[model samples]
Target: MEILDHLDKLKIFIAVAQRGSISAASQELALTQPAITRAIQTLENAAGYPLFTRNRSGMQLTQGGQILFETAGRVLKEVSDATLRGAHVRTEMAGTFTIGTYESLAEYLWPDFLLKVQKDYPLINLSIRTDSQRSHLEELNNGTLDLLVDAEPRHRQNLAMWPLYTDRFSFYATKAATELNPETAKNLTLLYVRNAFDEDNVTIESHLKSAGYQFQQEYTFDSFTTVKRMAEKGLGIAVLPQRLADKEGKLKLIKAKGFKEGFGHHGIFATVSPHRENDRRIKTVVNLLRKQLS
Candidate 1:
């Protein structure tokens, strides 16, 4: 296939960009770091964009690198996804597969995921429900939903989870707003989504409270979009997913040690009923989802 051929050429590029370093990429590909570095040099000559901008943080993808990464993700998905599709033949795969997830992830991430599933398996009815992860997990157990994709589904058992990606929370404020730290952040009203579960203990608010982080005036919104919009207008400082904030590009990241130390990072997982974990339909979707995001 044309897509497969294209993916082969970009495999090294994609692996390096995804792992953020030649060493990590080499480790993943089982190649020497020097070999990885030399391959990247070759790729840079062919690609119009330099592909990476190295900093102290490692190989940050340049605009061109980012573009290449996304493009490769779209095409290589046909291949990286082979884990799910590798051993399973889809010749007779046909059934309804429903994915239930939270509001923001569905809006920001799932368009391509669901679209690819539909394109590949037209016979299977694909549906997506975006209410709440908690309810979605329950629905999976009830057979109302086939997959529950969320940021670390908790408590419930008998479901097998596959890690897809990570979305970290960050402190965002108007570009003009005062720079924030744990102490100064208290001076600004905090706009955040209400914790869906108080007992979960994994929520941003719970972690902040436990860390002695304080927000003098706090506002809770049922929707993250509302919180983001309000924060953009300088209404208050907000803690939001870094991916969402990057898309807006207007909110400035606040340099708070607490926010910077990875307290808010959560792994996004695709979960399914254990019984159907190896079903062709399930594997196809999970690996496809992994390709789209990874």
Candidate 2:
């Protein structure tokens, strides 16, 4: 069997064993249930034995599965450490670097970042994963993500974070929408990304709350692009990052009494799993990104 394919199967097996169910592993890894099940079956076929005993209680790993889990885990860790160590000694950044971040920032930064990195380090392979949510430490800890650029998460002790820059947020609406002073701002409908309310690191709700505006009507969207588009069509006032808001010519930035200064700025961070703190290739990527933004 190919080493890469074997390692991929091992990863699926480890996730299943740790999560105790195929459904949970599928959810965590963003794979379909059948795909995860097929990986397990393929691994079992290769081993010439059943790895998990199926039951209502959940999958119980057999002796072979337990042995494979312990050994494969060590092998994965060792391979990662060796790769990072080699990267540290190399003169040029070369190797696969996977990064994750929020979609809004990715939309603004990724195209330029990708071009600059490829121009400087042609040998390096870069992969980017963008999501609407703020918490990606799970992917980082699992070794699927090499680096992340986002607002610092609330539970931050698990990963090492380097503060990159701050991006302020503000209220915006279509130019045709009703004028919003402090008194009128509270009456206008609100539209925003759903993660803004759910994530502790994001302060959209906090800013509105402090301004004493308890919006009676609100629209939540998963995409900042969509939120901005809706706001431009006179749907509602959207709370958006300053950079994103500035790009929309049809949208007018609100200058209410309490919010004239902008909602607030959150520090964007370049983060990695603590184990990669000393890896030079990763550091180079982070520094290049900082320079691109600067």
Candidate 3:
């Protein structure tokens, strides 16, 4: 007989062994007493040996029944454990989530979102790593990161993305440097983040190139924080996301006439493997991010 055919019989056998009576087992299992007896008989026929002996007081287990009872008890315990584990995962009750994002987003966007996640999922341990967009995407593909936030979404068959928020880019410098015109400013030291360049960078570069002004790159940093620090220290004028510039409060937004189109807006996106798209933890994080962005 198929193993599946013996499952119901095994269940009844276990129940009777636990309750020590067919009547009690039947009530516990929500089956009629006769039905429980029939199930026990089916198990005996399958095993080629009787599992229980009936007495005036109740049913008692035979030697073979005792062995099967122990085995069944272990199996039932495993089944219960598996059920609970699945429920916990579905509810996002526990697990560690590794998140990756570019430096700019990590600095500007993740503070509040991290606090909210901690409040909502006390059991979920979050590990965050900040890197360049390209490196973040590579880590995500290699399973090092469960999710990634980047200025631009990666184009890959196994990855999915969604827009988080859009922010404009702007040119900024310290108030002491306000007297420098855009042309003269290009001749001064200019700090740039090579890895964090997005579509906005392209627009800004083109506008500057067309204006016959070329910036003399004095320093190149891999992080936005470094570039912002350099600009605030009066080391150079830099192009920065408007939100960061506004938050810093140390830099003044340049109001040059032709530079308006240079402030391109970018949509932040979440990147993750398609296989993990339906994971409860990932879905919860995505929902929270969407809410924060909205």
Candidate 4:
């Protein structure tokens, strides 16, 4: 006989043995008396021996029934304990959290946020990936990222985005160019990161156009690192995220008059799949970023 098939029989047998009466066990289990009697019969048949001695007043467990009672009680307790432990483990924020970010924020913001998370939740194994804004959204849709940090995109579907912070784009140049004002901004040689500003993707190009200014010498690069380095070497005034520009500490912020009036700042946001927004571990990390980076 298979032990698994007889588990219900064992449970009823244990209940009957402990209660000392079939009717009493039936009441305790909310089972009909006939059902209880049938379960006891099944237990006896499986055991190949009489389990309970029935009498007018009550029932008594035979030697085999007594042995099963002891074993079943322990088994039930162990199973229940295992279930509770499993539940506890599920509640802990101890799992992989994969986050995707753009190059600038990944370089500027994530280092301090990571330190705080490690100190608080050491068990949250973290993985960070840097991608362009468009690529980040693609990976997020394909389920490759658990959380995302980037400039606010124009469209969001099946995703929840929360505003984290705003970063302004500013012109940075060598100390010699600090004397160059907004009226002459068009005269300065300018370094541009091609991916950083596009007419459809970012507002910088339109803002610069409205100011009646244009770069006299234009150098375009693919990466912000290159843009900043070239600007530091005094090749041109580079327009980059104010935070990233500040971090370089090598260039001076050249504030043009009326420059602050045009598309000055863009919002940065934290995004997650709609279903995972409320998850404890994901929420914890998002909250940590909002708190630390705000």
Candidate 5:
């Protein structure tokens, strides 16, 4: 017969021999008992020997059957592994997915997200890069980032944006700065994210101007972690998302009237390339984030 016939009969023979009963092999293969027996009979005839001896003890493999069964088991296992490998290559689950985000959010969320992703989708490798909002958006546009998690969405025509969560901005300072009076606090300097301008530069500028507050710009940094660290060290007061500040016990919130309206900003958003909007992996991640964070 053909090579396929040999392979199929060998599989059937192994199944029956391992199961020790033709009826059990047929049940496992979703075939009738007669069909399973006939397949084994055909295999034994092709090899010119009896593969198994039937008795009350079910079925026992003859000498020839033992050799074929051992060889076939390994071959089937290799074929199964190769089939799984080929399937992985054809799907998006096995490759690396690059994610971009701001440093602060990355610090807050990346650890937990990485843990969950690893536990659930172990095959999907994740690479996270932390940068400023502007740089993150640039990477998204350049196709260097498969996904972007940011506080604001880029207004590009070729990007798809989805809201993830909203967080409020609050004023925070070290315990030392908390003792400063309002007038003194105004001059204590303010640690603001340089990239906040990308969100609403004009509004912030106008608000600062109206408040007659001129911050010492000498210690400004592009990194959010640096901003938080400086603020914790009592270097200056800072305007940060309330969630981040609240999580740090060393910092205390400074509630001023009208501060919320001026400083409050948009929440987290997921940005994907227009071309990758329908990509299965991206869609799966977006959906999972929405379900988890929403």
Candidate 6:
């Protein structure tokens, strides 16, 4: 008779045979000693023969058991390989996965991108959290999130990153705003989005400082909505990413003073916990994003 009916028993037999002791199998499988013994007994009774021979050292496979072990191993390997292949092909997988991103991307970037994902993987549900990039990174590390889609954040250990696209910063306003440089920024109030969680504004300050960008007076708001609105009304110059600022084709660009084009550019990334780098769920989402955004 085929042992396929008792897959659990087959697994246990292989573990015991390889380890040479039921106790070792128990440790490997995280099962109790008595439980493993019961399983072995149940399997042997069905076959009308003991699969193992007892000895001073430990249990050794009987002649029939040795023959069955080889066949069982091949069957198990094939089953596992087939299952992995199914996942690799990105079909027949189900369940919801959480992805953390920024509010700007959630508004301008994800609508079309999400439609594409839904069309491709109808069963894969995505719960998108539009929070600050810093908060997303923390949630990712603390296991509250499965994946992250945002511009490059600080590299941390045990994290994996894949580039999606390069986004450049731009100056936008209702009218042709003054030239985008530190000197002109001091005259016109610099409008920028800040996360509520960023109490000290340390990250934004550091980022602007690196590019020699400084404004004597600034308009800091919690969301891009407020920043964009302020700029549209001719209140201040809005500093935003090119894709986000021009997504609707409403906002106009305010050219910079120097030969260098936009304020600066950064690579948008698909980040995840390093252990899940090759996971089918992660791979599927990342591939879709790369196709749409890159």
lDDT of each: 0.71, 0.75, 0.71, 0.72, 0.70, 0.72
**Where does candidate 6 stray beyond 4 Å?**
1-90, 132-135, 177-186, 193-216
Record all residue pairs in model 5 with backbone atoms less than 3 Å apart, i.e. clashing. none
- For candidate 4, lDDT tens digit of each residue in 213-252? 6767788887676788888888888888787888858888
Residue 284 in model 2: lDDT: 87
Question: lDDT score of model 1?
Answer: 0.71
How do the candidates rank by TM-score, highest first? Answer: 2, 4, 3, 1, 5, 6
Question: Which candidate has the highest lDDT of all?
Answer: 2
Model 3 agreement with the true structure over 72-158: per-residue lDDT tens digits = 644553454446556676554566677887666677678888898889877666778876566666456545577887775646676
| TM-score per candidate | 0.61, 0.72, 0.62, 0.63, 0.60, 0.59
Please give, for residues 1-294, the per-residue lDDT of candidate 2 as tens digits: 533456767777878887789999999899999999999998888888889999998887898877776566545755765586476665456667778898777777889889988888776778898753433555566565788887645557767888787767778877644445556765778898755632345457666767677665889887777888898788888888877788637788777667666756656788887888988878888888888777
lDDT of 1 at 239: 78
Lowest lDDT 10-residue stretch of candidate 1: 77-86
Error of 5 at 108 (Å): 0.7
Question: Measured by C-alpha RMSD in angstroms, how accurate is candidate 4?
Answer: 21.2
User: What is the overall TM-score of model 3 with all chains considered together?
Assistant: 0.62
Q: Clash number for every model?
A: 0, 0, 0, 0, 0, 0
Model 1 per-residue lDDT tens digits across residues 5-28:
334557787777766788889888
Candidate 2 has its poorest 10 consecutive residues by lDDT at 194-203
Q: Write the per-residue lDDT of candidate 5 for residues 1-294, one digit (tens) a residue.
A: 533457867667766875689888888789998888878778877788888999998999898777776567545644654465566886556555788887778776777778888998887767898766666665565455779987766476768888888776667887633333346555668887644532543343455556656654536576667778889888878777766776657788776555744264646889987867887878888877776664
User: At residue 89, what lDDT does model 3 achieve?
Assistant: 67
Tens digit per residue, CA lDDT, model 6, 1-294:
445557778778777876789889999999998888887787777667889998889999898876677567545644654565556565545555678887767887788877877887676666788876666765566445678987646566678988888876667887775567767666667888643212122344455666677777788987766787777787777877777788777778988665256645556778887756887867878888887775
Over 4 Å off in model 3, which ranges? 1-90, 132-135, 176-182, 194-196, 200-204
Q: After superposition, how far is residue 138 of candidate 3 from its true place, in Å?
A: 3.9
Candidate closer to the true structure by TM-score (higher is better), 4 or 5: 4
